[model samples]
Target: MKLVSLNIGKPAELSYKKKTVLSGIKKRPVQTSLYLSNIGFIGDGQADLIHHGGEDKAVCVYALEHYAYWEETFNRPLPPAAFGENVTAAGVLETDVHVGDVFQLGESIVQISQPRQPCFKLAALHHEPKLALLVEETGYTGFYFRVLTEGKVKITSELKRTEIHPAKITISKANTIMNNKNADREDVHMLSQLEELAESWKKPLRIRLQ
Candidate 1:
């Protein structure tokens, strides 16, 4: 797949529900190459570390294809990195990506960790209180990556698949189980056992399966 854009942003304050809040969800595309470390992109910032910006959820990746659907649904021209993804990719969707899939991105290596669980920050960033819910319902939520080998990454870099996990559970499947309370118990159990699945995601499933 192609790495369409590399985006980064610093923490900024925004008005949400008549209250000022600090967030780093509004990312802007960067023209130059950037370093990808264990923490995340060199210039990227995440205001809330509790739900984001950990070693397990380092690089957020969103599909460029989903932008069209969102734009049409909202009737607004969304900009690149609208979802606050560090990498905006094309030619790859959730259905095509699985947890544990390894790829060589630029000079670094990364592995798919988990599907992005949308939070209210998305709503605040988009100025639509229901946008976060809409993203979850649409199942277009992007995924995250954990850097396996730190190196430089640029917008011009290509995503070359190096390995695919034996479990082969697609990101879409994982999202369904995570968001759907009535999802099959067997599937939840299976996903929980996946070693590559992020603990943040597995914790809930484990609780549900209990």
Candidate 2:
């Protein structure tokens, strides 16, 4: 799919909260962006600055098809995103991705390091109170990456799948299945499937789920 637009936010607020003691609370949504300043490779935490990969961590340039979308369902403004994403994407599915997959953003190439798991900081911002729990239910929340190659990327740049290892799982299936299953069970079987697929790939595949 073509990259419709590129969006970057700087120094946006992040927070967390819980509505009722028993209910699954919404992750407080706020504006945030991926920083070119602090990024890390696999196993790096977003909070730690020293360990980050510098601009090498391409947290800022995201595919719009997957992470960011226009909410026609709401005349109201979309709630702020709890976890700040560097790239607001459209068609790129997160779970389907794996290490070694190369996402071509114009001339720049980015490698998938790991999934962007949710943190408490997101919930406190919007006052949703239980955001982390809600995100647990919705895997579409987005992720992080390290820039294998760096260059200027802007809105309307096409996102091409250049390389993907066979050992990777498409996050799209997992995310969709999670939405279908009842929320009561704490099932993460999708994660197992992802890991399984990740092991099967010899080389990375460059295909986005249409």
Candidate 3:
């Protein structure tokens, strides 16, 4: 899998309904290579620390193929980073890769940590309050990566799987279980017990089991 685009941006005021809130969702595509650190790209920023920009979610990746779906719905061509992702990737979809899978990307090493769960930022961006719901219903929610080796990366960076998780819990399965309140208890427990799963993702499932 390779990045079709690389984008980054800082938090800025955004209009949502009648209120203005600071959001880092609007990212601009960049052509130059950027330094990838443990936290994220050097110039990238996340407005909400409580929910974003941690080591386990340093990079947000969305499938380039998803763009076609959105473009068709909107009846317009959308630019890269339209989904606020740091990397617009091609080749691997949520069903193609599993959580904890390690990959050599560009000059850095990274691992899939969790499927991306979003707030209302995306809905607000399009002035469509239910857009986030549509994204979930479509199973187009993206995924995040935790940097293992800090280095440089760019739009041309390709992901070469170096290791695969034995548990084989794909991002599609994670999102399915996560959004399903009636999900099997054993499935929940199994996902929570994964050693490579992010603590943030584990905690919710752990609570549900209780």
C-alpha local distance difference test of each model: 0.91, 0.45, 0.91
Candidate 1 residue lDDT tens string, 1-210: 898999999989967887988888889999898999998999899888888899998999999999999999889999889998999999669999999999999999999999998988889888889988998888899999999999998878878989988899999999998888999999999999999999988898999988
lDDT computed for candidate 2: 0.45
For model 1, state the Cα shift of residue 42 in Å. 0.5
Off by over 4 Å in 1: none
Show where candidate 3 strays beyond 4 Å: none
Model 1: which ten-residue window has the lowest total lDDT? 14-23
**Model 2, stretches more than 4 Å misplaced?**
12-57, 60-76, 79-83, 172-210
> How well does candidate 3 score on lDDT at residue 123?
91
Task: Kindly report the root-mean-square deviation of model 3 from the true structure over all alpha carbons.
Answer: 0.9
Error of 1 at 75 (Å): 1.1
Model 2 RMSD vs true structure? 9.6
Per-candidate TM-score against the hidden true structure = 0.98, 0.56, 0.97
